[model samples]
Target: MKDTIKYVGLDVSKEKIAVAIAEEGREEPRYYGLIPHTTEAIKKLLKKLGEPSALRVCYEAGPTGYPLYRLLLSLGVHCDVIAPSLIPKRPGERIKTDRRDSIRLAHLYRAGELTSIYVPTPEDEALRDLVRAREDAKEDELRLNIA
Candidate 1:
């Protein structure tokens, strides 16, 4: 049997996520509509995608944080957070939209043109949060001293 891999690309937003799925060696990708950016919506998406072993998912890293990545990892889906700038742009591809972006990502990922960003573990996240909070507290203290 030939190796089959499904590539799922997601354009994540604050309120919703646009998804596209493409099987390796396939020319056309299937588009999944905008889904709410909530835990329930993500779970529903996983259900629709079926077994994790059958798909490899990817999304551009943005302000939404790593919640989706963490959630997908916990559920056994191999997920990657790709840097937006790492995706190649085709010249003369004038129109740009969520659907197009998602489709592009799917294609790039399938072609191995996407480079994934680093995803810190839970411990790393906690440490980073703690450091940021400490920095904010120190800034607040300095402001009070000047006042």
Candidate 2:
């Protein structure tokens, strides 16, 4: 519905993704569940979240990179990659876990308290990856030469 927006937060890691969700006019967000970290799993997650048009997803920028953002964009869903350092936290809030993080993300996202990082196009990401690979290769060569 045009009058409401659903906020989805994902705590993404190497093996699984922790999902949380908050709907418009709700005081608390809900922890959806954990899902595998794969394209197919993400597809299933999207399906469980209902219509994409009413959903806006956000996740911290971590080791997963921009692939998830790209996937959501391609699926016609709005998504944001937030800088981890920029996320807000309450005073003395030291407890950290995947589920809690996801819940906080969803709540903050719905409250407009999170900042989104710029998303790179596929071509730009590919170019950057190639450059990084070349740098790694050079480092390996330097190590072998020294040895």
Candidate 3:
């Protein structure tokens, strides 16, 4: 089972995604650069990862929502969406870059320190979207009244 387990960490942004791959006992993790944060890009990434047998993928739950989580599930890759704040911070870690974030995610995941967020389904996502839209519309109305 040790040989079959592969850990992948993704640092996702609106434009690009930084990926890091690590396996148990591997000295250094492999870093992959900016992949577009689109469905097509996600598909391509899963393909590049090869067969997903016993592979675990993790990413921080950011503004991107759960599209990647759902996509990975469809591709048979076990994925975890974790809260960004739940991850442990390194002391004096001033450099907050995507590459470094990805590396840190990989290391933390390997160390079993990541806490996953609850992944919502398609229906749940639709409901959430509706609620958000309604809130936005209400806020707009308030702004208009103030104006």
List per-candidate RMSD values in Å. 2.2, 2.3, 2.7
Tens-place lDDT digits, model 1, residues 9-79: 99999998999988877679878889999989998888887778777999999899899999998889999
Candidate 1 segments exceeding 4 Å error: 1-3, 92-95
Better model by lDDT: candidate 1 vs candidate 2: 2
TM-score of each: 0.85, 0.86, 0.82
Q: Per-residue lDDT tens digits of candidate 3, residues 1-147? A: 234567889999988999988777755777877798888888887777767866789999988888788888888889999888888887988988899888778777877899998888889989999999999999999999999
Please give the RMSD of candidate 2 to the true structure. Answer: 2.3
Candidate 2 displacement at residue 145 in angstroms: 9.1
User: What is the per-residue lDDT of model 2 for residues 70-143, given as tens digits with 9 covering 90 to 100?
Assistant: 89988989999999999998999999999999999999999999999888888988999999999999999999
The total number of steric clashes, by the backbone 3 Å criterion, in model 3 comes to: 0
Q: After superposition, which runs of candidate 3 have C-alpha atoms over 4 Å from their true positions?
A: 1-3, 132-147
Model 1 scores what on Cα lDDT?
0.89
How many clashing pairs per prediction, in order?
A: 0, 0, 0
